[model samples]
Target: MTDPGRPFPRHLRQALRTIAARVYLAVCAALLVWALVVTTTDSSDDSMAGVIPLLATAPVSLVLLVLPDHAAALVVAVVLGALVNAAVIGWCARALRR
Candidate 1:
């Protein structure tokens, strides 16, 4: 919905948010790929092996990528997502802070 032709504050803000979201999702996907690799490579016969939980995470990453049909639902999802992203990012920043 944002027009790149004009440099407006709202547009820039939205663009930044979109970029941040894509970056976050990409990081998650990368982690999922690593998990997939580990899950396949781990030869443990136990159902409760360390990599078993990785199997569960892949589906969640897939589900979150789905877009809701309704505008209100989309808005709610984005807002909630942004909040969660901010919290996690803040936490990570704190942990990694110098």
Candidate 2:
């Protein structure tokens, strides 16, 4: 039986699925870029580990500019990215739930 209480329409559901997939792909791509950067750079010490977080933040910052003025974009990006990552983690956890 269909759940009448469900709020999303078919198209909206599809769109969310697409967004989630894209976010997953983007995260994977970002990780790959980070790995490449680390590999190419001199591994003198643990200092190179810091670059991964910076690279991850850059794309999120760019995405934030789409919503508001440039000055507020950094704050918006950080908040939005945190929320998105949290959602992704929750989704994964639910999928793994027994």
Candidate 3:
């Protein structure tokens, strides 16, 4: 028989999962913001081309993690950012291909 005063086992598991998800999302947001700031502020000739996708994807991934309820917005952002990045890369590749 279950104890009258004790909570169900699944409740604790669910709560832990929620907390973990929030923490992961917050970390992703912080990383995205940091990378964005760095990329914008620094103007070295060394190509930062690689970091752009990381900047774009981090926020979207955070949204997916923390706000599963808002999956549409998150997914749209991811797709649009990816397409933009791809287009830019394709342009560069074509230019180099010539």
Q: List the residue pairs that clash in candidate 1.
A: none
lDDT tens readout by residue for model 2, 1-98: 33577654642344335455456546645654564566558466454443343346455645665776542454455446544554555455545553
What is the lDDT for 61 in model 3? 39
What is the alpha-carbon lDDT of model 2 when measured against the actual structure? Answer: 0.50
lDDT of 3 at 77: 53
For all candidates in order, the CA lDDT equals 0.45, 0.50, 0.47
Per-prediction TM-score: 0.33, 0.37, 0.35
Per residue, candidate 3 scores C-alpha lDDT tens digits across 1-98 of 43577666643333334433345445445654565566567788564533443455554434444445442544445444443444444445444556
| Candidate 2: pairs in clash | none
Q: In model 1, where do residues sit more than 4 Å from their true spots?
A: 1-17, 45-98
Error of 1 at 89 (Å): 9.9
Candidate 3: stretches off by over 4 Å: 1-17, 45-98
lDDT of 1 at 95: 43
Q: How many clashes (backbone atoms < 3 Å, residues ≥3 apart in a chain or on different chains) does model 3 have? A: 0
lDDT of 2 at 42: 49
